[model samples]
Each structure stands twice: as C-alpha cells, then as structure tokens.
Target: MTRAQHPAGDPGEVARAFEEMPAVLWAFAGPQHRVVAANRAARASVGDREGIVGRPIREVVPEMAGQQIFEMIDEVYATGHPVSHADRRVLVDRDGDGHLEEDFYTYTFLPTRGPDGAVTGMVVHIVETTRWVRQRQAVEARADDSERRYREARDVVLGLQRSLLPAGVPLLPRLRIAARYVVAGADAAAGGDWFDSVVLPDDRVALLVGDVVGHGAEAAGVMGQLRAVALQALVSGAGVLDSLRRLDTLAGCLPAAVGATVCLVVVDPRTGDLEYASRAHPAPLLLGPGGSARFLDGAPTGPLGADGKPARRHHDRLGPGELVVLYSDGLIERPGQALSAGQAELARVATAVLSEPVAPGSTLPALTADRLGALLVERFAWAGYRDDVTVLVAERQPEPPEPPALRLPAIPASLAAVRVAMRAWLGALGVPALPAQAVQHTLGEAAANAVEHAYRAGDPGEFTVAAGLDERGVLRLTVTDRGRWRPAPDDPQDRGRGLMLMRALADRVEVAAGELGTAVTIEHRLQRPAQVSAGAAPPEPAAEAREVPFRIEAGADGPRVLRVSGPVDLATAGELERAVRAAGRGGLLPVTLDLAGVTLLSSGGVRLLHRLDAGADPAGLRLRAPRGGAVHQVLALTGLEHLVT
Candidate 1:
C-alpha cells in the first residue's frame, strides 16, 4: 500500500499502519525547499532518528547543496509535472564516512493542491536499487556457457591479433614460403603477443612482431585496437614511419605501455634484398646450410607507441638458401635479465638447432618450431615470466635436384676433404661464394654436433650432408645423421662457437632432430648482402598493470577466500589467493584458495597439482595448492583429492 494517503476509517489503527510503512517518504514546501515530514527510511537515510524535521534539504545533504546535481531538480520544480530517476548513484550525507549507493525515486515538487485547491507542500518517494543491479549481473553470468564464450572470444581475439601481422609473405622468386605462430602460454588461453607477415602494397614484404602488452582481457582489448589501426594505416598507404608516429599519439591514453612492441621489416623480395625496423622485437635468426646459425645485426629500432618520435627503417638482403626468423621478444626476454642475456641464450639455441629438416620445402617449419618451442618452455615455464611468445621463419626455398653437381669426393673422414668438397659444390652453383676453409669449419661443427649428440657411439647414424642450388641459385649445404638427438648444451669452457660461428658463413641455418636423428643445415647464397640499418624501432611498451605486492594476515582458520578475475588453465593453476608457510623442504600443508575471484578453471588446471606435488619445491613457495569452493566440491566427488583445500 502507498505510504501516504491511506484508506480512511480506522483512523487510529490506520495511522499506526502508515507509520510502519517501509518506503522512505517526505513532504516539502515546493518553493521554499523546506522539509515538512519524513518516514523512517528517509530519516535514517540522512542519519537521524527523531530530530530532523523543519530543515532545508540543503541542510540534510550539504554536499549536494553545492554540487550541480540539483540543477535538474530545480528545472523539474519550475515545471508542474512529476519526475523520477532510476538506478542513480547518490552520496549519503551523514558525518564521518561518506557512502555512495544506487537509489530510485519519484518526486512531485509542484505546489500541493489542498481541498480548497491551494498550494501547501510537495511529496517525494525513495526506493533502494542495490539488489536490482546485483541480480542483473547474476542473470548475465547464468546465460553464458564458459566453453562457448571462450571459443567465440578466441576467434575475436585472434582475428584482431592477426591484423598486427604482415598481410602475407612477399613472393620473392628466390624464397620459398614457410612460417608459423606458436602461443607461449599454456593451452586453451593465450596472451597479447602477435606476429605478422605482410605483402606490402609496394610489393616489398613487411614483416612485424609485436606484443599488445598484457595477458587478460584488457591487454587483449588494446591489442585488438592497435592491430586494427595498424592494418588500416598500412593497407591504406601510410608509410611505416607515419604509422609509428600516429600509434604513439594514441598510446598516451593507455593505462600503461605494458603491451606494445612491434618490429617491422620491408624486403625487396624480387631482388632478395630487405630494409627493416624493430622496436623491441628479437633479431631474426639467419639460418644457412651445413648446420650454422647467426644472429644478424639489424638496427634495433625503438618500439611502437613509445616516445613521440617517428621510427626509422634499416636495410639488408637474402642469399638463396638463407632463412630469416623474426619473433616476439617474449621468445628471449624473461623476468630476470636484460635483452642481451636473452639474445645470448637465443644464439646458443640457434646454433644447436640448425639440423635434420634437410628438406627446406616441407619439413623445416615443424623442425624449427620444435627446437625453438622447447627452448622457451625449458627456460621460462616456471621462471614466472608468464607472457605469450610468437616466432616466424622466412627463407629461400632450395632448388629441385636439377642443378649441376661439383666434382666432390664420396663421404670422407678428413676435414681437408670436406673443404675440398664444399668449395667444389659452391663453385658449381656459382653463388654464396665462400672460402674453402669457412665451408670446412661449418661442416666440421655440423659433423661434430651430430657425431657427439645424435649417434649412440659406433652406431653409425644414417645422416649425411648434401649440397644443392636453391631456385635462386644460392648454395645450400646440409649435414644429416640417422639417429635421434636433442640440441647439445654448449659447454662454456669448450671452444665450440657452435651455430653462432657457423651463422657468419651462411645466410640461413636449420636443424631437425626427432626419431630420424639430427640434421644440421646451412645455406650460402652468392647473392650480395645489401647494407641495411640494424637499428631498433622506437619503444612501444605494452599497457603495464599497476601491481602492489600486498600481504594479507590470516585468522587462525585462514582468511576468507575471494575469487580472482580470470580463468585458471594448464599455464596457470593453484594460485588461489591463499598463502601457506613451509616448515621444511617439501613439507607443505594444503591451503584453501578462497576462489571467490576465479572465473574459469580447466582440467589441466586440476592436473597441475600432480606436477607440483611431484616436484614440490621446499625452498620455493607455491601458494594455494588445493583449489576450493566449487572446485573443491567437484574434486571431492571425483575422489581426486581426499583433503585438498
């Protein structure tokens, strides 16, 4: 029933019933703006019990008196119609702490007409809306299924992320196309990093590697926006520099540059020549035949969206048989070191990896991907640099078996014979002209890594090196062995420059190691090296999050749990916002993670517990071992955990 104007008759009882009404009600002098009466809700809303009568509305809500909020009220009062507002946040005007809440209300400040049709006072009604908002959010969540939401979201996210990549590889007559992008984070969920392979309108291929800067939705959002802007700019005719300048201007509004880096390369594909710019992207790994890898010097440009300076471009070229691999910094940059350290680590792996795929046309992508991916996982998995990684490989395709053969010896054991063999082979190809000695050194490294790592002593692995002319007529040399072998860890004390030294002799390096053993490959093209600036593009840091390391003290029973904001996948698990003290090495007590903030948890997330348990680090602390609430309940039914918190 309405709080005001009740049925007449039981006058005393009716008055009692009216006084107990729940809604806050008020009577005011329409023109004077003085309060005439208030029900319990209204009085309490203003922090009063019994003495709040006869005051102006301004006196009760002092803050509002100065704020422009009441301008609408004045406008309404001047007009003779009732007005209402819903779901509006208003500040309660009590002393001490000011609290804000959503409220709905209807009002009539027009002159109140009495029985004589005269003006006296206006009336107002108030209703709380906090519960309504909560209910709406709950309804939205219930309507969404996690699986469908994730699939739809991935399509959207990847589509947006793909724009940051080059449109496609340019058709250089000498080059064969092969490139791939691998997500660094665990399966099912990925981060803001991306790669690009564009066939520029100029016919020069423009390759880009960049990171939008963060892992979750916000990072994803910015990544999508930036990529869209880049494609629009480049595809429309904006030069690389103009695109960089415009991107920086827009970046000022970002939360922080925790997610921006773009390295772009424009190569004159027809001539096997190139010009490039890198913001913070990793230098491309140039692989050649004969098992050699080298980190080429590209003018490291600053990142995109960094300072407001236009980025400059650098230049270079590809010989037939040489390959260039561009990748996101996430491939090398980790939590505890500088870029050089990361670069060094990459070089070590590059040299060791250039083997086995022997066939550049079909098997190279898979072979290159495996070694590179393993390196990243081994180095960063638990090191906590939890960011996404992307790698792209580009190289000249080797020729079909129609090239003329050089006068060479049958597979021989002597180093001199190998040099004589290499010199004769390249001499016949008439490209990638290198000294006999250089060829021998590269060939020796390939043979040594294979003999030492791929073969099980005297087992005589079935691999052997071969030479040929690529379609562009560049020299390609490969060392193949028939036994399975992983990349050998370069011993620092040993003089083995490994692939790094071999890289200097050739333009591209490749290695394929699997059950088929290891193949060390290198390409030495006679194509002249074009001079290009190896400068970094300007810096485009991703939007970094503000992180304050805070510790929560727990009650004897542990703190009340709170859910996290994102899902927990194989890449991330058990960090349930709970902490436990460790007593000894491997001695840990199961701790409950409130999980109030957690939104998604995968089966692999459940499996992480087993991995963590098997390798329990006593000295290193891992928090929230056992997930709880719904997760705990689910695990309970499955008997996965008898007492997992």
Candidate 2:
C-alpha cells in the first residue's frame, strides 16, 4: 500500500473521491469565491448539476451567499483559521423546481495548506436544516388547538347548567322563595344542583333543593333525571316524607342506575306551615326573625353516586317571610379545613345581609350564593378542592299568588245545579255571543255521565265538569273520573249518544285513556259567520287511543314511580289515567281504563259517562264497578269515582 499505488498519490484520483462523497462539497482557488469544484450533492441541493459547476457562489444563491462566501473565504485565507455555522438558512432549490427557497444548513471552510505551509485552496460543506424547523412549528400548532377545544366544551356546559336552574321564584301570598345556582368554573362538569317550587294537588307549595353525587357532565345528567323524578313524585299528591323515601329509591334505580341527594319542602301557603325531608344532602339554614339562623336537622344518607344510599328526611315549618337556604357542597368545601368554620361564616354573612335593606325573603339565594362563592375562594385561596363548585339557595317570601294559572268554580253535585253554576260563572266572565243554552245542555250531559258512569254505584267516587276559556278564546271543557274500568261492548239498551251530541257542537274532542282512567275533553271556538258559511261541515269525532309505558307509585312528595314503562299521556283520553291519586297507603290502585291503551271507545260507554259526569245518578241500581273494560267505560261515561278525581 505505497501512497503512489494507493491512488492517493494521484491528484486526479483524489478529486474523483471528493465527487463521490455524500457531502455537498465545493472548493475555491486563490482568493476568489469561485466554484473550482462542486459535487453531485451540491448540484442536487441547488437543482442544478452542470449549470452551477462554474457559477459564482453568490449568483446561484443570492441570500446570505455573497457576504457569507466572502467572509468565510477571507477568514479562512487570511486568518488561516476554520469558521463554520452549524445551522444557517440558505437559498437552495429544495424540490429541484429551479426556485430557490430558504433552507437550513451547516457550513465550514478551512484555509488551504500548501506543501510548504502556505494557503492555496479552501474546502466547503453544506447540510440542509429544514426538517427540524418544520417539525417544531407543527408541535406548537397542535398544542394551541387542544387548548381551544377544552375551553369551548367547558363554556357550553356552564351555560346549560345555568338555564336549568329555577326561573325566578314566584311571589305568593305568605310564600317567598329565594333561589340561586352557582357554577364553580368554566369547564365541562356535572351539575346535580337544582331548585324547584310546585303547587301540589292539595294546593300546597312544594320547594326542593339538592345535589346529585359527583361533579361534571355525567353528574349533571343524573341530576336532571332525578330532578324530573322528584317533581313527578310531588305532583301526585305524595306526602312529603313518603315522596322523599320513594324518590330516594327511584333516583338510585332508573333505567340506567344513578344516585342523587334531594330535599322536599311542602308549604301550606295559607297557614305558613311547612314540611321537609332531606335525602343525602346538606341541612338547610332556616333564617328566623332578626337574622337568627338555625340549621334544620334531618336524617342523612350517603350521596347518590354510582352506588345509592338510603335516603332520610327532616321536617319543620316557617312563618311568612322566613328564609331557607339550601345549597350543594361547593360552599362548604371552600377550604381544605373542616366546614364548621364555613357554616359559621355563612351564618355571619346571613346576619349581615338580614340587617341590610336586602329582602332576605326573596333575595337570599342570590346574596348567599354570591357571598358564599366569594368567601370560599378568599378563605380557601390555594386550598380549594379541584372539583367544580355548585351552589343553590332558596327563601320564602310571604305574598299572595300573583294570579291563578287556572281555577274552576267549585263543582256542585246536581246536573241542574251545575248548569246554574256554569251560567253564573260565565255571566261573571262577560263572555259575549256565547251559546249559553247549548253550554248548559252540554254541561248537564257531562255532569250526568260523571255522576252515573264514572263510578260504579256505591264506589263512592265523583266526577268533576270544569269549563273554561283558554288564552286563544276557545272553550275547553274537561270531564274527569276515577274509574279504571276496562272498556266493555256497547250496552244493547243504550248506544253512545251523549258524546255524539257534544262532539257535533264542539270543534274538537280529545279522549285520553289509560289503564287508570280516561279524560274526555271537548273544545269549542267562537267562529265568524262568514267563515262558518264555507263548506265547513261539523267535524265528526271519536275516541283515539294512545299508550302508557311508565309505572308509578304514590309517595309522600307526590307520585313515587315504581317504574314508568310508557310515554307520558297528556291527551284528553289519557287525562283520567294520568290524574294519579294517592289515597293513604294500602289504598287500591285500580285497573283503570285509559284511552291511550284503547283503539276505540263504545258509544254506550261515552253516553253513560256523559250522563254521570253531568251529575245524574242513574235509577237506584247499585253500579257494581267492573274491574276492566265495561266498568271503565261506565265510569268514564258516567263520571264515576273510578273516572273522576
């Protein structure tokens, strides 16, 4: 391996080695920055092979090429020292498109050494640097996008949470309700916090506040389900305690299992008397006169989460203008310490608010939530829980109901008496051009049916005939009975005729039927003679059927559902069945007739109930209530107890 035979001895062979190297190598002679030699890679990087072989370095890549070329060459040739840039942007055709674009690279040059230690030629190297620059930019863009999506999901959930809170509390005589809801942060979360007020079948006002276990969207979803379940419980004439216990069970066991914490507060507005039950939730603060605050105690259970705990309730009452603050855990968990101090601070804040002109009766919820929310952050500071904050508050303001959403004249027993009452009530209403005579006749027919058919003789049930005008000036009459009798064939002696006449006169008739009972509704509108003259034959109507899927049980709060399998019925035929009655425990839940279950109704059944509802008690024969069809038809037609509430 002598240097001569190694090919290293030939200058031409050494030059060929440089061209074969992978590096983008180049060289310059003397002091001029001219390309004396350029390899294949340098040609490929600039998209020019032969075109750049003899080109000046500055002419091929104008940006930074001229200045850098001169500086490096001078530094190498004059200083006799090597200088290099590890990563620098240079203009080069990246895709071989002949268009030079900025790319990154490393470049270096060393002073040429002659055989006697004098400079002769310089060497240069280039390595493209675009890959690293583009990769870094992509990472930053992805990080920013993730942040934006997170914020959007959070804002949406918070907005929905606020809308679900109770509309401003209604001002009622001897009843004041202060309500509030607090959302902890602007992120996706479950909101099981809620407040509500309802008028019971007994004319009592029921108020409730509570939280569903867990926090965030899933928790909020379960909370909504439980809230609806609780409302249905209270509406069905459930006693406060019974409703609480039953709902506790249902909230933990729906189609999909979930758990909840709830409270029930039923108040008799007239007497300022109140009753309450607390499930697995906080004990409410009852604000007495002069800002005296007391926590009403109740039996507690574990909050409803994936697993449910037994629910317990507390009981109490308040005078007119008394304030009750019901809330979730966000307020108490403000600091990492025990909540006893939080409770005391809440009481102090309450006292301060009561001393001011702020109406604690109506404004307690807002004031309490705002103050409690702030106090929690201030006192807890960095010690706050990572969970979302939820706050709900309510107070009672003693005031009369603004106006009745719907009211009826007390129902009287005899058909003739009902006729008289209807006329008197209508006269007082100043209805013009009303067919009073036709109305009385229709009223009589309905009353008679209610009295005779809605109940089996001696069943002790009664029907009610209520007539009213809707906001649209349409006459709406409802015939409700308690009989759950299943429909039987039309009586051979008397076919259905009462409903026929009533339908001929009314513009629309809706029959809502179910297993429990049936509701027959008839509506009439005052029409213009000109419009009536156009080929407008009166519409002939008959019973239309619907379905009931849900199963319900009576609770102290209202209708405690054991299970609801069917869609809720709101039609006239289903009204009777929907009008659930919870006669003290151990009472019979009859196999009532509801039209939502029927494909059709017999004329005889319609007539019979029409007469009974009109207040007519048939000849002294005791109507042995049939358990199904025929009995249901009789009750629905006669306005029997089975059909009436």
Candidate 3:
C-alpha cells in the first residue's frame, strides 16, 4: 500500500516504523551537523548512533572529516536544498581492521525545514553499491587481459607463417615469376597452403604449390616439411617422379595423420621445357599469348600418403610467351559447387587477363605475369571464404630485366608523378596491397619533404626517386635532392607530422644529410598479406582497438551516462566508437555521453562521433561538453563542440 494511504495513528508507531527502514537513515541538528536521531540501520552501521547523539558527524566517522561529506552536508543546510550523489566513495570500519575500508554508496542529503521555513537540521540517506561497481571493474579487467593474450598469440602464429613462406621467387634467368597466398578469412593463424620456387641442377626452377588436409599450426608444420623435403630432393638430383615418391613416403612417416595434394612443375628457363607431376591437385592452367587457355587434366595419382599409387609424370613444353599457372584447390573449391565449373571460370579469367595488352614498352612477361596473378586473387578471394589460396605464375621471359627508376624536378607537383611511378614499380614487383600502400605512403612523404623543404623555390633543384627490389624482395626507395637540408620548425600547428607518418608506415626509414643534398631511404619487406582478408582493404593500424578505458553509470529511471576517460588517439578511437554503438544498441533513448572525464580526443574520435550523430535521432543521443580540458581544447580547435548538447 502507498505510504499516503496508510495513516500513522501515533507518534510512537511512526517512530518505530522509521527505525525499521532498511537503508541507513539519520538526522542531524545545527550547522555543525551533530547527530540528533538515527534509524536502526544507521545505528547498526555506526555501532550505536544513540551513544553518538549530540556529537558532530566527524566525531562518529572521522574518515568523513577531511572529505567532501562535511562541506556537502553544510551546503544543504545553508541553502535549504537537497544533494544526491551516485557511486559515492567512502571509508567504512565494517571489519574493524584498524583502518577504513573503501566502499561505494548512493548518498543523499536533504535539508529539514522548521515551522518558520528555516533549515534546522538535515536528513541523510545512504544505499551501498560497492558490490555491483567492483564486479563490473573485475569483468572489464579480465576481458582486457584475455584480448591482449589472444592478440599476442595471433601475431606469433602469423610471424611464423610469413617466415616459412618464400621471400620472393629467385630471379632465374629468362624466367618471370609471381606468387600470392590468401589466408582463410577466419583463420587468424597460418594455414597449410604454400608456394615455393627452387632452382635445380641444370638452371631449371621447380615450382611447387601444395595444400595439406587441414589448416592452422599443425598443417602449416607438415606443409613446411613436405616443401623442404621436396626441394632438397630436387637439389639432390632427383627427378620429378622421384621427388614425389619421396614426399609421399615422408608424409606417410609423419607422426600426425596428415595428407596433402601437390603439383610439382620443373621448367628449363632456356627452352620453356616443363616436366610436371600432379598428386590429385588442381590441373595447371596454361595460357598462351593469343588469349587461349587450357588445363592439363591428365591421369594423376591420389593425394600424397596413399600407399598404392605412384605419381605419374606428364611432359609439357610451354611455348615462348606461354604462361603456366600452378595453384592449390582453395582457388577453385567452393561449397556445393562443381569442380568443372570453377575450372572453367579460372580459364576464362586467365584468358581475359592474358588478352589485355601489355603496357607500351613493357616486356610481355613483366606485364602479364604480375597482372595475371594479382587479377586472379583480387577477383576470387571474397570475404568469409574458408580455404587458403596460393597461386604461382611462371613464364619464360626474354632476359628478364628490371623496370627503370624515376627522376623528377624538385617541385610540389613532382610528388604526384613520383607517387604514380612508385606505385607502378611496386605493383610490377607483385607486392601485396598492404606493403604496397606502406611503400607508397612512405615514399610520397619523403618525396614531398624533398620537394618542399629540401630545395629553395627558385633554386632549380632536381630530385631523383630511385626504387629497386633487393635479392630478398625488399623494396627500397631513395629520394635524393641537390639542395641542403632544412629542419622542420618546432610548431605543433605546422610541422613534424610527416616524419612521424613515414616512420609509422615503413619498416625502416633512414635519412642522410650532407653538404650536397639530403637523402631519405625507405625499406619495406615485400610479402603476401598475412592475416588479412583478400580483396578487402587491409585493416588499418590506426583503426585497431587498444584497451577500452571508459565506464557507463546508469540509473533505472533516468538517462544512461557513458563517461570516457583516456586519450582517444587513432588506436583507441575504435574502442570509443564501439562503446557508443553498444550503448545505443539497447535502444536506450536519450542516452547522454559525458566527455567531461575525457583527457584527449583525436580527429578520428571526432569523426566517429559525427558519424554516429548523423545516423542517430537528435533527441535520442546527447553529448555533454568536455568542460575545459584537453578534450575541450580539441573540440574547440576542430569546431566539434557544437555537437554537444
């Protein structure tokens, strides 16, 4: 029943009912806030409020003396107003440990009015909320720790996988080579699919592509062993059949029950002579310069480890200007699809890519081999695919030579030309998208610095941009200018970000300054995009999430408040975005985000908020101002404070 409906008959009964209330309730008299009357809960909390009557609150709870509680109580009494605080921290003597224990509570101080409308005393009410707050903190801590460990493990696996893969196909005379590996979308670790090229005794290169039965660390290990053994056998003067037989026997002796399908093709670079053996792998696609494509689907043995079958050798000669494609089944196998259909699709795409005209003045092998492999991976590797794909393109070239380096005048406009040339160069080298972008960004920044800062505007300075792939497939670009070096000004508003951007993007950035000129060199190790989705934009490091440093304080009958408190830089912006999206997911209308606690907010964080605001109903989401701190300064500078409610 409502308290208004239950009439109080006597003062004694009313007092008894007040004493039985659950929460801590008490009254104090005078501005000094001396205890006057307290309920049972208050008495139990302070170990006898009756004995503490007529005493100041400090005398009973000394821990509250130097804290804000005293000032809060005084403010209520003087202004005849009420104050409410949720999640208020206080020190309590619950365990009598000779020291106060930290606790959280919801506290309220209401002014008690006298007959003349003057405040004579105050009523205090408290509800403990320590258990809930502590539990939430513990959960968040555990989640952060778990995520850190998982990321570490994934990085280790990816590093191991990259180390095992070929750095780049060895530059065999008269051979144009390109290869790609697309890891499964769901596999954070490495998979079994791999490609390798090893030079044999008579200037012939053995191209191999293989796929183990399963994926992950174990399968990658087996794939590594098989690849190593097969390459060693060929180096030991074993023929194609002998190498396959040896690999089959080796697979049988492995401790784990592992099986694999492989295609081994040995090609004489001088004559386009090829002797290939397929162990139930996808038939190799041969593409001619005239746009005709054919798959060599000869009678082949079962996958390796099958006891009764010996792999049969098939002899083929790649005519001059004809390209041979070796691949794993992951390239063609799809759920519930016929293998023939996939094969047909592959032949059609390969033919189309081959038919495209080579860039004017570009060699046939340089233009076609790189373009074909990139085109296939770009077209086929869709998101959520379960298999790992490996494609290797080997073609006979006429004295395979490197692309020419670029040189340009030292001017701002020259940066764009340099960028285009570098991109084309990196692409011809078959560098994956991630490293390609890194090289392009780093090179562009260095070139811009040279054009704008290294040379005087009217000095007629010329900058040269030279790029080359090293023996181990590392792309190194050097931007050199003839003018002296000029250090960037020490101004946050204008200077020094370019160098930071360059260092962040490239594997290594080295700068040398002499009287003649300044040179900036950038190095990036070229490898297949590891732990990344193919055909999709590689996950930008700027968008990666660090620990989420924020909290949500909520109430049953009011707007939910999310308080974010940390430097929201590029790495942490994603976490802040996620926090806001999660809060909105509850359909909790009129959710208020309090940025008062935020120490910093970057442009990325600001953009994230704007995007959310653009998608949100204006009345459903409100942003509180960042109250004169670094966050406030940032919002002011970016003109983002207008988004605040």
lDDT of 2 by residue, 1-645 (tens): 765787466667887887788878887767665677888777777666345656666665543332234545665877677777654534444454534455556777876788998888688887766678557544533344346466546567655664555444433334434343445544436456676766677767777776665666666666676677778888787787667766657654653324566666776766657677766666777777676888877666664443444455455777766676665655566435466666665566555445433222121112332333333232222222344443333444454323212222223234434544555554333222224334543554455455545555456665666666642335667766666533334453454466665665567877776766567777765321110001111111111112223343332333422222322211222332333223212224332223323222333335434443333223211222323332234344444544432
- In candidate 3 the C-alpha lDDT for residue 637 amounts to 53
**Candidate 1: minimum summed lDDT over ten consecutive residues — where?**
530-539
Off by over 4 Å in 3: 1-206, 211-249, 255-259, 266-283, 291-321, 328-407, 424-433, 452-460, 470-472, 486-503, 508-515, 528-645
Choose the strongest candidate by TM-score: 3
Over the full model, what C-alpha lDDT does candidate 2 score relative to the true structure?
A: 0.51
Give all TM-scores, in the order shown.
Answer: 0.35, 0.36, 0.43
Q: Sort by lDDT, best first.
A: 3, 2, 1
Per residue, candidate 3 scores C-alpha lDDT tens digits across 327-418 of 87787776777988778878876775565433332212234666677657654542134687888988776543465477788765565566
Name the runs in model 1 displaced over 4 angstroms.
1-173, 177-179, 184-190, 253-259, 290-292, 298-301, 357-385, 398-645
Q: Candidate 1 or 3, higher TM-score?
A: 3
**Cα lDDT over the full model 3:** 0.68
lDDT of 1 by residue, 1-645 (tens): 554456674667765655567777777775656788777777877667345678767666654431223544454455545556554334443433443222333333344656875555567776766577457545543443465357546565443444444433332334444333444433324366655455556655566666776566667667666666666777776777676656666676775543277776655545768666666566777666665667767565566556555566766676666667776776666555698877765655554445322222221113233334333333232223345566655665454234322322222233234444554444332222223234544565565555555655555444466766533334567777666764445433333344655675567888777676566778654332111101111111111122112223343453332223334432234343223322222334443333333332333334444444444443232333223233443344333454333
Candidate 1 local accuracy as lDDT?
Answer: 0.50
Query: 1 or 3, which is superior by lDDT?
Result: 3
